[model samples]
Target: MRRKILKVLALAPFALLFTSCEKKISHEHREVHWDRDMCERCKMVVSERNHAAQVINKETGEAYMFDDIGCVILWFKEENITWKDTASIWITDVKTSKWIDARTAHYDTVHQTPMAYGFSANEKKESIVKDSEILNFEEMSKRVLQRGR
Candidate 1:
């Protein structure tokens, strides 16, 4: 009995460490395996940490990952998705590498993005650059659609 209690005490820290090390994914965004999870539209690996995009169905909570924002836009057109208007779109901030709401982020059109849309998103306009063209989500989407990639 004494030996068993000592063993349990010795292993308690390891058990706690394992449990605490588990990553906690939030409801807003799902876990992504960079370079492993294939993009839904372009079929490219989402290896670009700053250019990856995610679209989630508002009702069903299904997430579609893309290697670039351009792929996400083209995917909606190709699939004829009806839930796009109500979906939650997420993109990585080029400066911080943090996930941000794509619809509300400011975009700069001078990056070597994965799909070559030349657009990169950031939460703050000042972070993008000084004297560069900045665009809202709607404007960016329109420009990307016009490109028709």
Candidate 2:
């Protein structure tokens, strides 16, 4: 009985140490279900392979999927997400349909998007016409906010 009590006490701190630590949240993009997963804001099925966006709360590592950048923009306004400035936004490259860092990717505002946002992300993978204007993340967000649609 004394040996059993000592063993329990010896392992208690290790158990406590493991349990007390907070679960680490991943800042990376989550897997998309494509045509099955619904948008967090608009509730539309995320079917557009090239236009889907996901915003991950940097602090909590929670990902909110969106069918369009327009929905993402409006969701920021509607929800007043406190972590907006620090959030990690992921968007698919227009040509490759692969996830890319949205904040760092260049955008051209000419394509027809799912939500009519008209902004397509580029990792320089999508060939643009000569002298086509490219917008940064901040600029694109401002334009989307200004459009107010």
lDDT of each: 0.89, 0.88
Give the range of the ten consecutive residues with the poorest summed lDDT in model 2: 124-133
The lDDT of model 2 is 0.88
What is candidate 1's local distance difference test score? 0.89
User: Against the true structure, what is each candidate's TM-score?
Assistant: 0.81, 0.84
Among these predictions, the greatest lDDT belongs to 1
lDDT of 2 by residue, 1-149 (tens): 99999999999999999988968889899999979999988899999999999999878788889998889988999888888888899999988899999998889877899888888999883465556679888899899999985
Candidate 1 per-residue lDDT over residues 1-149, each given as its tens digit? 99999999999999999999986544387889997999999898999999889998877778999998988888998899998988889999997889999999999987889889988999998897877799999998888899896
Candidate 2 TM-score versus the reference: 0.84
Segments of candidate 1 deviating more than 4 angstroms: 1-27
Distance from true position, residue 76, model 2, in Å? 0.4
Error of 1 at 142 (Å): 0.6
For residue 145, give model 1's deviation from the true position in Å. 0.9
Clashes per candidate, residues 3 or more apart or on different chains = 0, 0
- The list of candidate 2 runs beyond 4 A from truth reads 1-21
